[model samples]
Target: MNHKRSLVRRTAAVAAAGAAALVLAACGGNGDSSAGHDGHTSKSPSASASASQGQHNAADVAFAKGMIPHHRQAVEMADLAPSRAESAEVKKLAEDIKKAQDPEIKTLSGWLTSWGEEVPTEGAMDHSAHGADGGMMTPEEMDQLKNSSGKAFDTAFMEMMIKHHEGAVAMAKTEQADGAYAPAKKMAGAIITSQTAEITQMNKLLGKN
Candidate 1:
């Protein structure tokens, strides 16, 4: 009876050991799966952000490089409003343009710097055209604006700024379509919305609406 009882205890101990080993193995398998899932979750966003930051093409570069000077010119034009503008509304509109565009100029510069592209110098901006498509004023046109005052300044400023804002909107649209950087594309969208609104406002200010 003692030997039988001892044999029964030994068998029970072996069974318990087998059960514990199975539990441990199962836990280890689950731990590995959980770790793999966590790794994948962490990597997906990182990979997406990396792609967004690095995937820009020449069009993106052009957009940033071109916009810097464009915004600078707008700010310059806005600066003339305080002294030259006859209407309070025109002055306020100019102030609004400055408020909106100065930061955008800096943002465009930052993007170009991050992309290792050339940041356009103020003196080097192209200014020999006019239209809704990236239009810029010639030196003579800018001088004419500077030389004018009172209602003439207000009218010229409105007309010139309306054209300028249209150009920015065009550039912004191109960036929206082609820019790889998420931040840049977002800025582009913002530019389109704001500039389009400004264009409408300027048109109304000019009595075109």
Candidate 2:
């Protein structure tokens, strides 16, 4: 009887916690720190988060190298939505993605700076462009997306972004497996968690989730 009663209590506690989480999401109390230096998230780091904290292997550097373009595409997509999306939810979500990620891109730049790694001149020199799922777009593809109209734009965005996110998840998985630093590993886990949710959100918006 004691064991049964304890199990019941634990179950009730879990259910209550889940309900509280739902309430928070519904209230738009979404909070994350370590997002771009905006109050939108609880913790956004600075652009100067230099990468030279210590020595790292080629794998960790490669992860950062590849992820930069992956993130850049995400920011580009988010930036495009203000003019493209008709749905308020989509627009709001896009704004949030840009605000959160723009600073993160800089944080990664800081890491590259500290590590004596060369940041890409623009969004080109994409590591993902070669292999990582062809995880990035060509300039022509980007142009096509830019000129796409209405629901056409929405459809393409969801399809391309879902694929894009999968590539980031792959990179994060690699980072977790091989990174020499704690911060890199932690950020990789965070990317996996955050992008998984955002991809789901995008799918739901497209009525595919």
- Per-prediction TM-score, please? 0.72, 0.69
Candidate 1 regions exceeding 4 Å error are 1-54, 128-132
lDDT of each model, Cα atoms only? 0.84, 0.75
Identify the candidate with maximal TM-score: 1
> Positional deviation of 35 in candidate 2, in angstroms?
45
* CA lDDT, candidate 2, residue 187: 81
Supply candidate 2's per-residue lDDT for 134: 43
Q: After superposition, how far is residue 176 of candidate 1 from its true place, in Å?
A: 1.2
By lDDT, the best candidate is 1
Candidate 2 lands at a TM-score of 0.69
Tens digit of per-residue lDDT, candidate 2, span 60-101 = 788777777678878988788879866777677778767767
Which 10-residue span in candidate 1 carries the lowest summed lDDT?
A: 123-132
Total clashes for model 2: 4
**For residues 1-209, what per-residue lDDT tens digits would candidate 1 score against the true structure?**
99999999999999999999999999888887988887899999879868767677777887887888888888899999999989999999989889988888888888788778878887776753223477787688899999999999999998998888888888888888887777788889988898898888888877789
lDDT value, residue 108 of candidate 2: 78
